[model samples]
Target: MFKSFAAKAIVPPALAVTGFVIVCCLLLYSVIKTDMLNDTIRHETNLADTIIKSTRYAMLKDDREMLRNIIGNIGQQKGVEQVRIFNKKGVVAFSAHHAEVNTIVDKKAPGCIACHAGPVAATSMGRMEQARRFIDARGRSIIAITAPVYNEPECFAAPCHVHTAEQKVLGILDIGLSEEPLQRTLATLRMRMTVFCLMILALTVGGVSALLQRNVLMPIRELWEYVSRTRRGETGLKAPVYRDEIGELARSFQEMAAKLKSRDDDREGGSDPPADR
Candidate 1:
């Protein structure tokens, strides 16, 4: 759609660069998003480990009140959606929400399915496998991780000694956190990257266009003007100053014009225009 030579020369590379930048921006956003998510999950995993460690003594002593208070207190913290512990049988033993306690948790839920889907339950899992992203009841984005509570030596060796050595996993600690902060950060980053990419594209295209106009288009226009005046039999033609092919072409045109003018002057002087000389 461009009528100008500068547009024709500059637009294609500019468009290519634009598409490349867009793709790179999208890939960068995806990687940043994944890394941020993994970082958040790792942080939550550490928090889960801390919670398990803090409540370990209470659990070993069979102190239900203290365990409940610990879980309940953490769940009340800002950004913590919920903190609950479910027994091996998928029964909620201790939870921030009292109504959920003693209730049977759905083993098929997003947080539990990775461990419970197969015929044999998983005793351990990777950090990435432990987390799940979902929307809560209030339509807010949330990430939940299920940390398997292992049956350590202290647990089975407690005074009560209610567990066996064969028991690998004692229970599961499920913690949910809000994802709003991450989402907002990503949105801001995306906008800034878009603006930066646009600025770069403008500078690149503008620079290329300026160079083409100065070096190529200007010389060609000067040559065309010289030729147009010569074609119209105009005198006193202003020679086009060029450093390249246009310069050579202008010199040739000037020579042809001079030869024609010489033949006309000879005929006007009645000097018998030299035939084919």
Candidate 2:
């Protein structure tokens, strides 16, 4: 009876609960990781765009100092690692880190690699193609995005700048943002989610096991005990009633017991013998 109760009432629910918890944890983790990645990308792209808009007038007036100041100020914003303006020749025309100004960008660098597939840059790139991610020298993850500076009437007509009608792309605005802060936040959230799921799983499984033991296993055990007592000649034993297959079995047992008792009573009351012949 103990073995039967363990198998039927305990093992199945435990296995089910474990499988359910594992699947939920995996699905939740996957969703959280994807959302984190998208948010980081969007944030970096927006920052790059903001820098481009703020420095446009300075670039048109050929004011190097104003452009440097704008890029430097934006670089101080939280999570922004570096900012640069690259000319068509792949030269660092301006940079937040002043030391990097005038330095030539490598063809294989994250910011330029997608556009400069070979010796020349791609004639045009879609908005989505300008975003990339890589690891920095300090091993921190970094998201880099670029926004192209296009030639407009104001740009070509500026007295301080050279005129060019054929030029479509003037320069590229590049921004790199650190992902360390985001990574830390995600790690903490993952830990909390794991703990919460485990707690719920434990409570659910425990409640189910307890209910099964009380409603199913206990009644069956009681019926078995009642039958054993009756077999030992105990009187007045009653089979327990349940509303399932077990209940039907209990009813049959009670009927059999009553029949046995009636037969015993008849034998005990009968007259000793039909006088032999």
Candidate 3:
């Protein structure tokens, strides 16, 4: 199939273009996916901060019922998978799911191990380090943040507050957001990028093929036809206007034709009988 000039010219470029497109598209998708994931984490972080602020009054009053109700309401919002508050003792103080309340959270759990597994527990953590991704019992992917609720001046100063000022951290607010929405967005982006890649490949390959035919293939085919007609003793052939190597080939053919005609004329003159003197 590739024996023909057109195939030789077009196939290599087509394959090269295809490979280039595939590589570029893959890189683009990877960058977009990473950016989207980081955005989700930032969003979950912001939402966790909001929840802490929302329940601050209840926390100050030591009102467990009000805090639980607040957590339950936040959990009902879209993209929120779970909401729970656990004391420093690893005991669940309140949870959006009431059944989980008063349960002991294992230190080896995914979210807790990062802060508690070491000999010296982490007293503080960076924003990004505080976040984690895990699958729940229902097999749903979740991106959760564990925000530490520290004991501020206002907390210990409250009339209803119980803990002494020695407590650095009172509890932890753990909120998990569903990953389904982020996954859907990535899927859509991948589909659109695939379509775009195909379109670009077609345009690039088609354009290159058209240029080759016009600038290279057509002229060579015309030269071949000219030679064939000359072989049949045809005369008065007009040379094509070409500024490149093909033009030089055409000039050589014209010079060789002129020499052959001159030789033939000389032979005929010599063979003819001399005119009467």
Candidate 4:
């Protein structure tokens, strides 16, 4: 009977604690993961902007070789996957991978649609609207940011280039960076969080179980043993004092047992012949 009672007391609360830990851990993981992803995106966007600024002088001077070299050098960096400049006609004007130069990019692709919302909007695309992300052919996650190469005064005024006041947007500079490193970092963080959560769960269950045993289960087991001894005709049985509802119960049982013993003594005195004085 005590074994059954102990199981009932321990199992339910342990399960509840485990459930609560899992729920809280899941919520925390979601928030951290989202923040990490946004930080990665912001970092990659700044890199793309730097690339555009670095190539601006070459673009103004109409130096195709210099522009190609800049793009190729940056593209070879660790995190950069590819870099290219797409002209107004969706044709690749320059690319780090030279084979891609002169190839026509599909208008429906995310890179093109970023600037080319439609035929009319494509001509007036602002510098603010060029960032997007997608997965590449090799199943690697890619984040692409587009910076518009505007036709500045120096570009139109240069003797090497023809006048182009009407051409607000000269071309689109696209930078593709790999997301594999960020993904790996997030994976490591997730594993650590899971392990930490498991540790917390184990500690909580152990703590709660120990508390219940000391305050509840152990007292109840002692009370059961006292009752068994009393039922076997034992005398002078004393219930342990406690400060809980169980303590009150133990006091009441002790009072009742004392009253029974007193009544039995009274009956023995009455049955005697006036105490034989």
Each model's lDDT: 0.90, 0.80, 0.86, 0.79
Model 4 root mean square deviation, Cα atoms: 4.2
- Model 3 lDDT at residue 272: 49
lDDT digits (tens) for residues 39-91 of candidate 3: 88888889888989999988887888898789999888888899999998989
CA RMSD per model (angstroms): 2.3, 4.4, 4.4, 4.2
Q: How do all models score by TM-score?
A: 0.90, 0.81, 0.84, 0.83
Error of 4 at 253 (Å): 1.4
Candidate 4 runs further than 4 Å off: 1-24, 117-119, 122-129, 268-277
| Best candidate, TM-score | 1
Candidate 3 lDDT for residue 256: 72
TM-score of 4: 0.83
Rank candidates by TM-score, best first.
1, 3, 4, 2
Candidate 1, residues 1-277, lDDT tens digits: the string is 5977878899888998888998999999999999999999999999999999999889988999999899999989999998999989989999999999999998788777888899999888888899999897799999999998999999888878688888999999999999999999999999999998998799879989889888888888888888898888898887787768878888888888888888999989989766664
Give the residue spans of candidate 3 off by over 4 A.
1-24, 232-248, 265-277
Worst 10 residues of 4 by lDDT: 121-130
